[model samples]
Target: MSPKQRILELREQIRYHNYRYYVLDDPEISDAEFDRLMQELKALEAEHPELITPDSPTQTVGSSILEPPFTPVPHPTRMYSLGNAFSQQDIAEFEASIARFLGREGPFAYVLEYKIDGLSVNLVYEEGVLVRGLTRGDGVVGEDVTPNLLAIPDFPRRLPEAWDLEVRGEVYLPLQTFLELNARLEEEGEVPFKNPRNAAAGSLRQKDPKISARRGLRGLFYGVGRPETLGVRTQQALLERLAELGFAVEPHHRLVSGVEGVEAGYRAMLEQRRALPFEADGITVKLNELSLWDELGYTAKTPRFAIAYKFPAEERPTRVRQVVFQVGRTGRVTPVAELEPILLEGSTVSRVTLHNESYVQELGLRVGDTVLVHKAGGVIPEVLRVLTEAPRGQTPVVWPSRCPECASELVLSGKIHLCPNPLCPAKAFEAIRHYASRRAMDIQGLGEKLIEQLLASGKVRDAADLYQLKKEDLVPLERMGEKSAQNLLNQIEASKNRGLERLLFALGIPQVGESTARALARRFGHLDRILEASVEELDAVPDIAEATASAIHQALSRPEMRRFIERLRAAGMRFEAREKQKSQALEGLTFVLTGELSLPREEVARWLEAHGARVASSVSRKTHYVVAGAGAGSKLAKAQELGIPVLDEQGLRALLREKVGQEP
Candidate 1:
């Protein structure tokens, strides 16, 4: 076939595969196979540049001209954010207001849907084909994301037979996909996305339709754009019709007859929310009748017809009794505040993270300060604020100059203080603890308390030391039995085979997170190469900021640090041994990944990092590449405007394998 024909065929095949994998959740070809086809197409296009077309899969990443700021288009019906009711009393008040408005309400029912934590989108369909999609910019007007929206599988490129219609829904990424995508980004030395919501928002705003398509973004239709077209007089009917049209509708939507029922539905949704696939911060309670929605109308920024019953803020107040400093696996000193007993979101709060010295200084917190402590999303406990009036005599907490566990003097590297002594007992304890973490070594029987006991008893001083412990050594320690000791040993033995990335992460270098570790592994491909890297060489790696580079350099230069690394090397720690491969396809290319992917992002990142490419976390003019996955959000759009090259996983792999004669 001619090069032109081959390029077109390759594009068609990729688009079809995208539809199958993203929209249908079924893929006929293996990833490697799909990559091979893409490689062939890219090669053909490169040889005959004249064959490149606007719609070609290879063109998605390099477009730099951004369409001007999105002009606001008026919504047929003004979209409104909901008013939140934080408590049952608040809900009761709302119910009373509704009853008064309706005049002697005999029965009123409510429908409950999970309040998806994502960007809101308005899709316009003319004659059953999607024409344009817009962001819920300001409820009444939004930015056009027509191209990006078209890429979404569930978005319905062609709608059901209808004259004209508009549908409202959320654009989001699934948790599983999010985790995998972030892992890959990390592997490429790119910063992982913060959350699923952010990822979704970024994906929908990409300028290139093809880029958006590559990221597996999906939309769930919830409300109608023009109620008149649906011949629907009630919200319940509108939702049912949407579902009937094959849109992914919220499964828990229900219609209850009155206020009591509404309350019950709200509670029920809250209870079952955890089981849902997507993240939901609250439940949305909307008026069931469309006519009533008009009657209730809207306020300036919110609709009166609907009220969002927000889950209580997961916050609680506790007294700060004292501050404690702890050394992390990387030897960074972290300050933790001990809190007085307080109940918070069903759990007793005793302590919270103060992060680093910078955080503590920002809060101007002191010992004996009464502080509001709460877990952000019922997960990580953090100090929200300090109540100054609670105690005037409280002293300012002093940061320790020496490590608490081992009296090593703390060294300051920019904002963070570090326990630079390689043999510091606390640092060793942290390293060992991290090695046994679920994501690391998967050591099942080793809990923090147990680890503390073992450390206190001097049975294990380093991560490798755990491998040397005898059954009797552990069995005698606190609650450890023969079975538990054996289990722990088995886990340690299993960990010996963990790949280079995990080992790099377990080493706990300053500012070297899981993602950074993966990048280092892929770039250096061996522990010895990394350990021997000078500060300047380390700094040259992508995303290795100045501070982090210096810290790693200083740490490795120490005799103790060298000894530790040598010990690990002697103990048979595995490292990447292959010569660096080269791929001209992605050479001089940089990528910034946003959102989630089906495969672990780390795998993709490793491939790229090893193939003479750069991957970044945030968007910038210097960025040469963007490998957007599902729910890519704003970064995708930003990349397009900046004229950065964007690639899907398949395209990226193909690019890496190009120019077989050279090393990646």
Candidate 2:
């Protein structure tokens, strides 16, 4: 055979074996044999890039280079999230609702499949060739994660036959894999994912596909966007067809005749859930017949034909060893429960936040008390209740009179405790980290370890001190080589020009989020103006609540804050705002944007908001315009059905330019 023919042959063989091992749970060839075939294919492709195919198994390793914020891809059909049913009564009510909607006295046949606790994704195929993979970003448009999707061994690169189709699935990390990944993260001193679902999501969103390949993510095909395209009539038939086409369909699905069958299936799955390799929080029950799906229709957020029967939250008994105080960047003191190390939902549970003083009092919790801890949805370990009272030698939980990190007297404000000292070490550390966050200065190389080093050495006392650091100063820190130190210094210098809004946010003013900062920047046009503005003047700005205004007023009036502002101004930071929009062209209009756009949705929203347009997340009669792009889903359909004005990207841009009489 010619080299091209041999490569094609090898690809087919490898794809078949991948299907056998990953989808069918059977292996026709050893790993060594598969590696040999893959190596030959890779060498051949490297020699002749022109012969390379998108679906080549070699591409599954992903690109060596990383690219952030993957481009958005629209789904052919809306990936509606399922409404949850926590109790048996909720399930019965759901059945009754379906019957009511169908106007039928008899119970409807349904299919029950385990709802994998993972990331929802859609894979599109053209002529039996895998073309694109997308995340379920907003039910309409999603980030194009084709490369990452290909990294999963179970994610098919080609179908059995040449056919156009779209299959929806849950991409997940198995429980064992999740535990190992978290262990590795813990070893690296990096924060581990709270659950398998979060781990799967984080893995799939990695900028480098190679990272995803190592994550051991598996996909289970469950639903079809258009089953008729593949000659499938029922949900069960759809799953079977998908399996035949070399997709991993969850094997535990049951086809039940009526509500009773659904109840039985639910019970069986709940009992057997622990035996499954992956985490499944619930069982999804969908109407069996595809013909009735449309008739049953959908609500705004979920499909009416289906509902998820969630299992009860997993609870375990553990002792609260201590209640410690954590001071946030804004000086708010929160009580945190330090629990005895115990495994919960595949992760080690060591700590849970108490939120505030009121929360601590409400639980009547004390040190050495055995408490019932549970992880709801397999995330956020929380203290459910006190299972056993404090032991005889245990003491009542004491509220600290002063900040632990700094000797500042604690003050009660409403239900929460405040450290009040702006210069508190804990607050300074948190403030510096927040200032360097992506949403603020976006200092790429400045992370927790480096910031901690700077704090300890007294090289940086506040956010402004960051701009003054030199390469020589950073090089001495652990893990900071000369090159890395220089890069960090470069990033810090670049951040000085991030403009007035970002500077306002980076200042760490209490109650001033990005939106409020943007509003203040636009209204005053200069940092000096904002600093000089009275509380009444600040309250007059749009979107600035009275409380927020008061907080900003108090924060800026402090002597320490005034000195900090002066230091920032001395560092050559950009303090003047950008030009304000001259016209309120879309003053009375509200727009809902859906699907892929030339620019990001947030950027579009910001521009529209600058011109006095209200951006609504959903479509309604009140929405004056719907900006629809490629692959626009239910929102687009709803807009057209509701007689709401719809505009494509080009049309929307044109309208904006025409209204403002200038480029946006």
Candidate 3:
């Protein structure tokens, strides 16, 4: 393909996969394959620098490098990234910038979190349920990865109350899990993974969500997309609120004085780095006080109040002892280089991740070859470069042809080999697990251990069998008490109202993601209609392509699947689509809200945003309008200064009615 054509093709493929991975929780290509495509795109972008565009996948954090599987679902608000700080002066300048913007240094505390080396995920919850999980795809538009997120054990599916809000966090694999996974893969004759960060990212982007589930991925939430809604006045309180609402918050955070506190905390963290369970790239310094976040607002892509104090990427010489393939939770086999023990930074390093088959091939890695090893994020080991000279005569590293565990022939999807066996133990547990996941049927008490116990007892055959579960059946299991059993049943009963789209997604049909499910549910209105619909009718549904429609139709047509649906239907599950979304009449319009409004500002903001308005914290010249309330402050004054259109609560309500004609 020509450079331009190749870039376009790469972007198209990346986007499609992003949709599949993020929106659908059903990726088509493996991570290695996706990475290779990305590397090629990056190489081309570098060689032809003029070809680069702001919207290019190369420019976005669509999970580490290769941008979202490729869906472009807009976030309620743009999720901003952090600017970097290399030295103490950079950190000082960060505080100085905040003070300069605020015109004072009053109450400027700092909150520091180890800049986790992982993919950034945004979560949206409404009416107590987590509706969507998205990647930070260019801030405004992110790919939905909710189902994959639901696979994360600690990720809250529902909040304590019916709270409508967004939470942001870093999703990563713990170091011990990474080591164990790599060890198991190596023992099974599969290659080991080199870095935990990419492994975590790749795990989340699997076509089979079971990959994410079985991989034991974890999340540490630290951000509230709009803290204004929660009445949180500081960064530390926001985290505490997250914990109270049932989220796993990183405990390594501290709220202290500006540069000195940050430097001290960073130094302490560095001292205890090896003891931590996960990888942290740097120290994140954020203004502890949240109220001032608006006053000292954002630049184009980053906030002025926050900066990442990055650890230097240093390398050391190491010899490759052996190369091994590590099959990940999603059946993605990545290459890991076993190295002769060498000191890197301060610790002894023995293994380094080669990333993928393409990466290893690119390096032309061989046994006993010298290479430069560095810690990616100063935690995960990565082979920076191959130092060996000419070794053209050496045999190339052997790639696996079959799954290490199941011994099933691997299907080469795109540029990566994947084990397509549905019953592979590596992926089988996910079927029922996903069916009971918070995003799906939402069977609350049905955790992994319980599912394993149930499966071992042979009382449950599939997700459909979950409906057949009895209290007596559970009481006999290991730890399931009468109360636990009753609670589980109640949860299962409640899951019936999760609606058709969630059920369709939980069914694990090939190429059928949440959006497709919603499309199908909306078009058909009922499960019976969808089951009865021909491929032609299915194809005619918006966004359901000919191939995807065919796949859906065929999957639904299967006798076993029919039986599964029948059982679920018999279980009193509701199969219905919500009303089509209201028109985005306020799309492209930016609004800055100010003062204490009579109506809850959170609700008001949510309403405006739902109909497609951008609610910014700080007023800028680009702001289209300013919604001012009672006792308006400096923001109101600024709005007046800039001559931006100002509206009261009633005025805003009238504007919404005029624009959308209803409470959309």
lDDT winner among the candidates?
Answer: 2
Which ten residues in a row are the worst by lDDT in model 1?
60-69
TM-score, candidate number 1: 0.60
lDDT of 2 by residue, 358-412 (tens): 6678777878888878764455576767865545216777888988877766655
The alpha-carbon lDDT assigned to residue 357 of candidate 3 equals 72
Question: Which pairs of residues collide in model 2?
Answer: 128-163
Q: Taking the candidates one at a time, how many backbone clashes does each contain? A: 25, 1, 17
Candidate 2's error at 489, in angstroms? 3.3
Per-candidate TM-score against the hidden true structure: 0.60, 0.53, 0.49
Cα deviation of 305, candidate 1, in Å: 1.5
**lDDT of candidates 1 onward, in order:** 0.69, 0.77, 0.74
RMSD values, in order shown:
16.9, 19.5, 14.4
State which candidate, 1 or 2, has the greater TM-score: 1
lDDT of 3 at 564: 69
Residue 45 in model 3: lDDT = 89
Ranking by lDDT: 2, 3, 1
Span of 10 residues, lowest total lDDT, candidate 2: 59-68
Error at 384, model 2, angstroms: 1.7
Comparing 1 and 3 by lDDT, which wins? 3
The best candidate by TM-score is 1
